[model samples]
Target: MTQDPQTSSDASGAPASSRRGLSRHLVDIAPLKASPAFARLWIGGAISGVGAFMTTVAVGLQIYEITESTFAVGLVGGIALVPMIAAGLWGGVLADVFDRRKVVIASSLASWASILALVVLAFWEQHLQGLGTHAPVWPFYLVTTVNAITSTVSNATRGSVVGRILPADMLSRATALNGISFGAMVTVGPALAGVLAASIGLPWTFAIDAVLFTAGFLGIWMLPSLPRLGERVEAGWPVLKEGLTFLRRSPNIRMSFIVDAIAMTFGRPYALFPALGALVVGGGALTVGALTAAGAIGTMLTSLFSGRIAHVHRHGIAISRAIQVFGAFAVLFGVFTWVGMHSGHAAGEGWGGTDFSTLALMALAMAGMGASDELSAIFRQTMIIQAAPDEMRGRLQGVFIVVVTGGPRLGDMYAGALAAVTALWFPPLLGGFVIIALIVILTRAQRAWREYDATSPTP
Candidate 1:
């Protein structure tokens, strides 16, 4: 039998040295060197992502400021959920059948328009006061839902484009790079949004996102047209059914989705950050930004030192373990919040009035969760890209996007609802344990998933 290139010795066939150089752990730039198109897309996305995140933070703040309700804030995700789901399924079909480049460009334009609409609403609320003392929150939800739908489609197309652009071996490195991109956006975007919203105002903060969106166009414009790889099918249920059928057959891929859904649904704590900063941790917007950025900090560090991730042959085991670690950290975060509540530390008044000690502990726990989540993301994405057939990549990627994005929305609902009824800390504390138990049970039931190997590309 031929030795697997991933684990085999060099041409000499001698045992490979176990000692990889220190440089092995750093962010691999080889993918950038190999594909200029991918590099451009990556850089453009990174630039635009910061602006997008700023908008995200600003919207949450605006909603909270208007209503002072965590449930209202969480409803943002709920409103977007169904539309995003439809877009994911339909968009995957579009990506597979139509020109992916065009699909991305069109979706990007829609997303840009949504951001611009937000900009208009923000300005209107500040100067016109058209809807009363506070801006009508419904419009915010309407525009963000549109943005979510378009962005979800755009993401599925973009992910498909990556597989077409890069070689199979480079997929893992590319996944790592993608993690770094996300980490950068999550870290810088929220922080910038907080500072911008706090200093200038919400209108200007949203305007920045609208302005930054232009960068994405530049990257997509440069890409060569990418047509469908298989027999072109109409963009309808038939196309979606085909993809679903494939997923049903692919146990490893299905398991990947299931595990991710479990983690996101149970372990997501982001929806509570605004309330925590305002009512629990007490640094206001700044504290929210810090807590939000903490997870990205962990993600960034993990990606930076992800040198050894590419060598792991047992991707299934890695993904499972990483998610478990994420759950553990999430549980820890809940415990920290519970302790702070019991300690009777009054919530801080504003940005400067934070409970730093408790905030630090919570941030640390969130960071740990972020790091583990990123690790799991890297492996799961690599599995999807490498294991699935090229023709099915977009559809699978669409499902992946749904799981990735939809899971958090569900988490938002879970956290928001549970927090409204109980203490802010209860959801994650309960969810984390649920994640660990469900994942262990599910993985054990699916023997194939537990023993999955990257070299063979089973899914």
Candidate 2:
């Protein structure tokens, strides 16, 4: 094994895939030392992800308790979309123009600080008389906004770091590891958040989130300094324009974004979880935990042995197939829930978890969706990180951040809107089918995406 400064040139330059021959279709995931730097980052990310999950659950629970409306919870996520996108793009641009490590550090600190603010609010709720008496929405929105912004920035920077540290050959392994971390977070964080919120109150969850963010900071701090990729530019619209221009030239990348957006917008079923848990699923909060955890469990299972995917040169095709699987699962999830509703088991009104007895079926559907999503994510993330130029990584990341953040919100809108007109289960049932059909159609229509070889990428 050897380390060379000139390796990146191979990634971007002509002969297309000198990293591994086309014949080398698979590799052992564990032996790919890939980069120790990335390994450290992965560990830190897992920690932060767990805490982030806790905060997410806490925020939703608190909001639901305060407003007693599912709409409010969905609204919080949708409202934060703009700032998150802006911060992500800006953060990516900064990563490209400045030291990525520094950008990550600053943003990580900001994220941690926001959580600390949440911590303070928790104590205030417990101790301060006036502060706790009048529960305000603005502060909650503000803290959430700050958290979203910083989180996007941090993600963009971290992604850029992945592009830098790992050889092209091991991207799948890296992607798999990322999936595992996220899976673990979802599996661990939400359940913990629910318990903490139930027992210790909401503030403590935020405090835990603050502590978790620190692990990411340490990972970034420990990294060797890296120069900005490509060229440097001023921090405003010019940088943004450059990134957009790059995206425009690349049909696959653009299409990838569109595909993800569609799936997220229509097929996302998160906002409906509470409703399903209460009215249809037959369990209470526990059902929600099981459903969500089921999905994470699916993702974790896939990721555990995903070492073989590193050999795949055709990432585009992989993503397309994975997304279709995601859609199919979503449809199944909806079907089971819909069945529960038709069986005269509703929380009596709108769709709340209706049948706690049906928990197993719901969990299976959620798990399917989870597996498909994780697989799709592995390819999508790899494409984004490696294909984009180093100079515009930040801005691109910002855009990426928006897509990631807004996808579920769109799903929320899909579920909420469809539920208003039709039924709670209709959104996923219909949305899932639509997603699978569209992703398959789109990928087949676009041959370039299918041929997007990771080793020697065509941008």
Candidate 3:
């Protein structure tokens, strides 16, 4: 009888290994072990991420404190969106044409400078005796906008560099590690920002980010030069048009972007957290922090045990299913908020009041939603990075950043506008249904997308 080649034989010619290898399904760390450069970059980014989140929270608090209007606070994201989009696209072209290491290093310095400017402004505001509650909002916007643009470019450049550093088989595990880094950033950064801003004030928060920015510089500086491969194109409108044309031809890639846009646009409920904490959940700032961190906690946990996901072959189906689960959790979160609001709990109360039961339920729902979204992100990113050619990876990674970042900004607008007319709970409840139904219909129409295989990527 013929024997299977995969099975090991004993000295007596009997099969020695019959049990299947479960380790193959586990999160593979070969990429980290094989490449020292990738490891340094990853560690630096993770450390810097904590500082970045601190400034993000501090800036929003400063804006709201000065203006006292939700509209003004929302405008922070809206104002930066257009310039960020342009930077993302333009940066992609530059990454393809220039040395990626130089692009990243230059952009990192610009970001560091912007953070330093913020520190100076914060000090100026504190020293002025008669400034009262309001500090100049324009400078805050200006520095943040500059920071946003430079950070976008640097992120796009680094993403393109990942493909060059790691092998194709290890891409999925690398993405999982990235998700873990992001999870840590979101979880720890905001919490630290709140404590630091309250105790040490805004200047120190910005200063911390400025100091951490050096790690990013060090990581980029250590990398070997990465010049453009194959035919090079000038960084201009023609290059941008070429990338778009390629995107237009790749249906699977287009669908990945569309699905993510849909999920973020309809299901994101972060804009309502402040209102819900104060008037509905009754824990005020503490409640808001809990809700915000819950999602990141879920993301971190999912990535920690992402052993099984590495073996998934049908990426499209996995993405669609994960997103659907995310939508379902969003619906549950909305329902919990609505019930809590009507349950005679303390409304509009400050931080001292507690509503543990309702807060726990809402947090659980948000955690579920976060985990599912992270799963989908891992698959979608892996598909793009592995499927796209090395030459076009930079341009595509730029587009990916734009979609991922821009989608939430659009969602903020959607949730804020709808909550103004209706209750804060109405938008997520309705939007969740929209996300589920729309994704189902869209995926059904694209048969090729549902059947996408990792071993043989179509796009």
Candidate 4:
């Protein structure tokens, strides 16, 4: 029941008696006003996330353009999976063993260097095409894989440190704010990348992403030293083994991961976007950007009104219900895509002439999925961060990152492979049904997870 010294003051950094009333239904900004360090960290991550998302859209599009295969584009996530998992595991151990601030800064630099390499190769490819030969696709894959490895380390290190800076009561609010940041990243980044890639080209698009990454440096660099909080653990096999052992013992924490994997593995439809834009939905890159951004709009709207969620203590039930809604929306999205395909909409000039009516309906469905997913994520994150003890938080957070990230990679494969055999619409339609059924079965079987109460966290 002890609190973080950094969050000791009221969120406004004012004496409790003098504070004015704030809306309970709005996103609480107290975390920002209460701790200068958290504010800087949040700001830096928010700015940098925009650039990261931009790079994600650009990379996916580039691969699709090169191979003309949705499966190849989906392979981007599969390619990074093994390396990212290793980095996330070892990075968690490193976070627990060394200074977390330094770990993040080092990883950030490595990630930046990888992005710069992308910029160089992009321009080089442009030059090559102008003369005779085109640059090899292997280099792009290699650099992105390296970036994924570094990014996993940075994410694990940074995620583990948030608990050190914020009080337990504010954790929910902090997560909600992160949702807003995530919303902005997806909303702004993909849209901008689509415009830039269509107008300027990939070289400049990559260069802009490189420039934006600098903001993250200020966030991690300015944080106070964050060493391990409890019993010391070295980075080795024993530590990794210990982390897994703890997860085995904690059913609630374990269940959180399982449910998320179900939702992401079955419900995610991102891998289909490039193909939809190119063939089914038309408007190419613009359609891709709009479809991606549509989900963010829902995420942002949900987060903005998240003030009331902090009062809810039944996090497990809340997570279960939210993901069910997410599945329903996924099914809706599949229906829209199927309808658009059957309607025989003429392909536009890659940026315009999209079937606005069908696109709008699909975007609406995607937005619903985003909102529900964000709600589930807030509670899942809060549950993990709050339930785990100080010494084990790093490792648990690492696993959380793995589930959060790895599931999507697997989903990319699922969607890509299924779409390859069937049609783009079939994966989401069938997957959505699977997610809804699996979540219900899993939660019902895991009684402890279904009955988890936030007021008395068991992990």
Candidate 5:
């Protein structure tokens, strides 16, 4: 006979009432030892990501060495934004429509080819065409542009694979794990690149990236075959239109992109680091590099204990809060910079002069920026991966890549323009406040997103 309802507490004692259900939901998550495939992918990605980071730092140094123009340095992302978008979006549709594995493999190969080409160019040019000695801008632009496009495709396809390989329940864990891998790369990659560039040569940097390509191939090759979605649709505007249509109806995905855009547009201030390091703060190029790497360190620290993050269900809430916190950190960074700059004016006590305390404070701000950004990024990727279907995950992820990659490019312009017109520290401080305001403004307008449940399907 069934026990009397009155005798037991909390809704018939079904062992799955809201409170207990919530507890069980949290109890389940993947252990690192479970999936060797995931483990292998994570390891390979970590390795390749470091290589990518090396290439990133190398490119910046090379460009600066060649042109000695901040504007040219900004152009790296600015010029590539369009093709990256085109390739990323189209690549996403292809991922959903074709075999995601093949798409990733092909893109990886293309990226590898570009890196190898750079190595070759460096070899011949250093001796014959005078690469490092003379600095011809054309080849620099050509190889980098091609590399950016291929990398976008590779990025989108890899995201699709994450959704496919991991079950829905484990997406957050996988995403968190990926963050750790990415963090490792970011932390190690640039430093290694800087060391290698200074010691061996830029050509060797490119060569290193070429070697890393094989690891990515191993990651992809080990994956099981993934067939395209059964549905056949036209490739061009219609497929793109489909992605847009989904976003239009999906308040969560839509809001995530919109808020992130707002944050980037207003809060992003990386472009100012070099300027501050030189004219405003006083450390020089090495200091700028330190501030850049500090963010990666924050990300690495967050990933070290991502266990608690998996239990949070109100992810939208998490996103909004993390971003708000991020904005605050950015604002504080600017404030510290401004105060330090003025404080060290004539007597040389602060950042602009000979103030050691000033340098430490700036480093702290940069570290805070890194921490806030890492948390936001973890939530951001989770929303994208779990919300979209496998078929369209690639395209959606592609759009995400474009958003992230493009956001800073716009920030570069914003920072450059504002700094030229105003004071040195104005951009980050002013932009940080704007980010806070815009996030409030944007999120208040989207109630549907706030109510979105990750467990449900998109209508």
Candidate 6:
């Protein structure tokens, strides 16, 4: 039998006598040992992801501080939607046309520059406050929107490069490892943002993100050049149309996006964290950070012990089931928030005054959401990476990014708008049910999607 490249090498990159031992339940780390380049990319991306998420939390907090309104906080995502969509589409085409390494490097630089801009604006805001003047909020929105665009390009290109670097058998394992990257990003990042913002200020918080971004730069810089594999599509509406055309004909891929859209649109409750912390759950910035990190904790744990799942071939059913569980957790989160609000807990002091019991319950619910969501994401990503042709992978990943990023923004709007009219708890309660109902309907309508097998991906 032909020796697989993965098991052919030991940690020293020498020939090995036998395959490395693997735990049945722990995450498979063979992919890392097999490819040094991927390991670097993964580590760099994880570290940078931490910083990026920090900036995310800071920006949201900064907006909330300026406006003191949940809708305004949610508007941050709403404002970036169109530009981000354009960036995903354009970036996808760029990835398909240019050297993917160069595309990622350029986009990463732009994203880092945007973070620096945030640092500058943050300092400017501090200076203004000293003079009894308020800095304009538009700058924050503008900078974050630009960051969103650049990051989308960088991310889509990076995602596309994964399949190129690793063999098909390893894609699922790599995707699971990505969950760890995401976990680090969200779990450590937001929590640190809260501490830093509370202890130092927003300027320094933004500055730290700027500093940490360099690690990601190094990772992308070291990658081998990856150019188009076949006839490169022109970077324009035509290329986009081609991608859309592909999607229209591919039911499995289409259903994956659809199911994820349903989950993110209704089940996402992130936009409400600021308000929930301030008025409902009453822990302030600390509460917000904890709430955000809780989901990542669940994600990290799920990824940690994903060994058995890597062997599973029934991806479509796994995705559907995972998302349904996510919806249930979202509903539980709402329930906890409702109970906390009725319990008459006053807004606590910054980080120290949180209602620990109530916060714990809510965090548990959020963690459940994170675990289920990550499971579904793992399968969805694996299907895309394995099923799509190499030439079309970039474009397909672009559409995937749109759904991944856009769905949450729409959810932000939904949560924000609904909360604006009703109580803070109503949106998630209703949205959760909506998510469950829609997933059931959508899953039933597409039998092919439900029966999609990982071994024979049909995108």
lDDT of each: 0.88, 0.74, 0.81, 0.87, 0.72, 0.87
- Candidate 2 residue-wise lDDT, 1-459, digit = tens: 443534433222323244354322332344235567777788888998889988887777666556665666677777787777778777877877888888888888888888899888666655643455636656787898888899888888787777678766566667777888899999888777766776677878788888788786777888879777554567777867788888899887787787888878877777776666656665545555567788888888777756446546798888888888888888888888877877776563212534655667878877877888788888788787778766656667677767877777667766776776788888889998898788878988998998899878765
Candidate 4 C-alpha lDDT tens digits along 244-330 = 899899998898999899999899999999999888888888888899999998999889888667668889889999999999999
Highest lDDT model number: 1
Candidate 6: Cα lDDT at 417:
91
Off by over 4 Å in 6: 1-22
Candidate 5: tens digits of C-alpha lDDT, residues 204-237: 9879988987887898779788877666665677
| Candidate 3 C-alpha lDDT tens digits along 1-459 | 645636865222334353236643345565678678998898889889888977877776666556654555556667788898998898888898899999999999899889999999888777762555556788898888899899989999999998999877778888888888888887787777766766787789889988887786788899989999997667889888989899999989889999998999889887777677657876544565577778888888777777556558799999999999999998998899888888888765445576778889998998998899999999999999988998888888888888887787677778877887888888889989999999999999999899999879988
Task: Evaluate model 1: give its lDDT.
Answer: 0.88
Candidate 3 at 227: error in angstroms? 0.7
TM-score of 3: 0.91
Residues 1-459 of candidate 1 have per-residue lDDT tens digits of 856545765322233353246765577777888899999999999989989988988899888988899999989988899989888888888899899999999999999999999988888777645545776789999999999999999999999999899888888889999889999999999998878887898899999998888887899989989998757668788889999999999999999999999999999888888888888778788887888899999998889888667678799989999999999999999999998777777887665667888999999998999899999999999999989988788899889898899999999999999999999889999999999998889878988988999989888
Cα error of candidate 1 at position 344, Å = 2.8
User: Which candidate, 2 or 5, would have the higher lDDT against the true structure?
Assistant: 2
Which portions of model 1 miss their true places by more than 4 Å?
Answer: 1-20, 128-132
TM-score, cand. 4: 0.94
Model 4 pairs in collision: none
Task: Flag the better candidate by lDDT, 1 or 3.
Answer: 1
Q: How many pairs of residues collide in each model?
A: 0, 22, 0, 0, 2, 0
* lDDT of candidate 1 at residue 451, scale 0 to 100: 93
The stretch of ten residues in a row with the least summed lDDT in candidate 5 is 10-19
